[model samples]
Target: MLQAKVAVVTGAGSGIGAAIARLFAVEGAKVVLGDLAEGGAAFAAELADDGFEVMFQRVDVTDEADVAALMQATVARFGRIDILVANAGIPERKSPIHQLDLDDWRRVIDVDLTGVALCNKFAVGAMLATGGGAIVNMASILAHVGQENSNAYSAAKAGVVNLTRSVALTYARQGVRANCVSPGYVDTPLLAQLPAAVRQAMLLRQPIGRLARPDEIAQVVAFLASERASIITGACINADGGYTAI
Candidate 1:
């Protein structure tokens, strides 16, 4: 569905980002996988061995220079960018707002919120040059609701939702479409790192009594990036398995 497209997926080494990259590749997009983790190169290599058009780059989303380089590399390799998934983010430790560590808060904001800003800045520039593109920013259910002891992550994701809207409104005239996908408790490596009790608590909070699969979220992102969604923009679709429905 995305033939001839070049897609850049940040945080593509694992979890939702990795799933998105794989889906894009399966759909015929030349994929550029970016992440701070060392696993990014390995992931790309694995996909390449499978005969997919994929490349990997080590990128620190919190660094403007690194993000700029990532975009530059994508264009250098593929000539033009058609899809950008600003999916890199970090979850801060659970703590009350009043007791939150200042550095932790800043770190979360930098990676989760400012990181999106930087990616959008560079991706939109390329899209405008190419006359159009699609961008899907990864947000969370926390974007629309409060989470106890997750002040930084919740706030940063909330900013991402609004930023997605702002980008959509500003660039639709340029044929650029921007939207957000808000997922709740997706079972990814990150969630695996959490304590069992915490993970169980999150699962129980979902009316469906289960965490979403990573590919399920990927399907939503794929739809948003396809011509099938040509008329959809500035939308924040929920993939929460009914967590937000309650």
Candidate 2:
């Protein structure tokens, strides 16, 4: 669906971001994988080996300069950025609001919320210059429903949802569309870190009775970034497996 398009995926080192990068490449996009982890380079190389057009750039999403550089480098490499998946974020350190450290909250807010803002800011500028493009921001089910001890993460994700809407509204006539993909608990490295009991609890909470796969979420993102979703903007599509229904 993304044939010949130039796409940039942040946090492409592993997990959902990696999956998005790979899928975009397979769909014929010139993929630029950006992450703070140097490992993203190797992942890009792996994709290139499969004869996909891909590149990697180390990017600290929370840094405005770094994010600007990412968009610039992508334009330099692929000519123009047709799609941007702002997927770079850090897992929150769970703690009750009363007991949460200031640093923990700030860190999560900075990366999860501010990083997305930075990406959108620069990507939108680039897209405007080229007439138009699409943006898919990675949010979570937490954005729709709150969880105990996850104040920072939930707040940040909720912020992302609104941020996407604002961008969509602001650029609706400019040909740039912005949307959010809110996923449920996914079977990624992040989920693997939880205890068995915690994992089971999440499964029980989800109506699907199984965690989502990274590729499944990637499919959602790819669709949002493609012309298939041309009329979609300012919408937060839930891929939560009915987690919020109950």
Candidate lDDT (C-alpha), each: 0.94, 0.94
C-alpha positional error of residue 148 in candidate 2 after TM-score superposition, expressed in Å: 1.1
Deviation (Å) of 38 in candidate 1? 1.1
Q: Given candidate 2, what's the lDDT at residue 179? A: 98
Clashing pairs in 1: none
What does candidate 2's lDDT look like per residue over 10-76, in tens digits? 9999899999999999899999999999989999999999999999999999999999999999999
The list of candidate 2 runs beyond 4 A from truth reads none
Worst 10 residues of 1 by lDDT: 89-98
